[model samples]
Target: MFKKLSIGRDGADAQARGAGAEQRALDYLRRQGLRLVARNYRVARGPSARGGEVDLILWARDGTLVFVEVRARERDAHGGAAASVTRAKQRKVIFAATCFLRALAEIPPCRFDVVAIDGDRVEWLQGAFDVPAEH
Candidate 1:
């Protein structure tokens, strides 16, 4: 993966870079034949509680509902961009997916995906995570 881009100071710059990464990921997925269903789909459980969000919700050619999380890093270090998707992040994405599914009459085969952008290079990982099994 490429590793030369420098994100500017402040939260806004990081947000802009994140949005750019998402756009790049969306374009790549579109080229791969995935239709966009939603972008930045979000939900909140309560007024005081943290919410969930899915970066991109897409429909694969085979009819799978794909929930994608787009991540970016200036350099691949300490496990890189893909490894940045931690368990807490996965839970938020999963929670958002559940909320999204509730609106559908029939649940389709679903998957969690990651679009990790390391500088200028991008990688798409299918089934990047799953709903954690209960104890």
Candidate 2:
């Protein structure tokens, strides 16, 4: 099944591009005074009841934990890359975040953020979504 959904070259290319975009976004966030905490945090194991991952985790000056989703697109001809984070995706992020917090002896206030990189422009959406109840 994993082989069936393999992204192949295109997927690899997209991942590289996304990584570049994420680095830029992280730099921008740091310039704005947000402290960097973690990156590419994986929570799941495999595809089936497996594991999942979070793109970035950050810390605010006020002690807020930020889970960031970095998205990039050449243009918004469709809904743009930011729109790709659907409700289901948000849930996954929330779940992963919960797991991250649980592993910590101290949990802090946190929120979901989405950074959209459209060409040369980067837009940051803070508190993009609420954590799901089950998490």
Candidate 3:
């Protein structure tokens, strides 16, 4: 999966690039038969605060709920995008997912996926990472 790592210049421009990458990731997953559940899913940790942002959420072919993180970098400069998902970031995502699950009647099987794009190359890591229990 070769992706040219197309990202915007900086600031809001960079955010737009991130959004674009997310859309591309969503489209790619749709081609693979994943049904979209949500995009840019966010959960707040407080009454007036911000929390983690899940780039994309989808139902997998086997019906497993998927929480996706789309990372687009200019290059694999610092371990690329997949490697950028640190423990702290994982905690945030897990936190958001927990919030999402609370609204469900019955929670389905879930897994975390990452779509790492670096310099025109795309790597889709299924069940890429896990949620730390301590989080």
Candidate 4:
């Protein structure tokens, strides 16, 4: 005798799709010559603030520290996926990035970037947003 098991197909499919998108984005960045430093850096919550995370941290050949946010959408149904990184999201990313750099003795020149994956197309936006002031 044999038994068959079934799982949540939709949820599993979504996760797999997301993972593929992230990998594709990473490869795209590497091909562009941005050295990969770290991925998915998380910042612990402060006393009065909720913590957040950065998707990717990269180092350029020119010694520039880059904080990257990767957003993936099945399709550009709502002004494209890049447009999804709203002001609130950017602030959270900036906050997390500041926390990350504070732990380092020497802070390098830094920038923000957005990697948007729309289907098979990948768009890399450098200097996507200015570094937010310490709050």
Please report the TM-score between candidate 4 and the true structure.
Answer: 0.85
Model 3 agreement with the true structure over 38-101: per-residue lDDT tens digits:
9888986676364887889899999899999898898899899889988778877887888898
The numbered model that scores best in lDDT is: 1
Best by TM-score: 1
* Residue runs of model 1 more than 4 Å from their true location after superposition: 1-9
lDDT, candidate 4, 1-135, per-residue tens: 888877766887887876677688789889988888888888887895777788889898889999999999878999898999998889889888988899899999999999998877899999999965665
**Tens digits of lDDT, candidate 1, 24-130:** 99999999999999999999776637689999999999999999999999999978899999998998898889889999999999999999999888999999988
Task: For model 3, give the 10-residue run with minimal summed lDDT.
Answer: 44-53
Considering TM-score, which of the candidate structures 2 and 4 is the better prediction for this target? 2
Q: Predictions ranked by TM-score, top down?
A: 1, 3, 2, 4
Each model's Cα RMSD = 5.7, 5.7, 6.6, 3.8
State the C-alpha lDDT per candidate.
0.93, 0.84, 0.87, 0.87
Cα deviation in Å at residue 77, candidate 1? 1.2
Task: List ranges where model 3 is wrong by over 4 Å.
Answer: 1-9, 47-50
TM-score of each: 0.89, 0.86, 0.87, 0.85
Kindly report which residue pairs in candidate 3 clash with one another: 2-120, 3-120, 3-121, 4-119, 4-120, 5-120
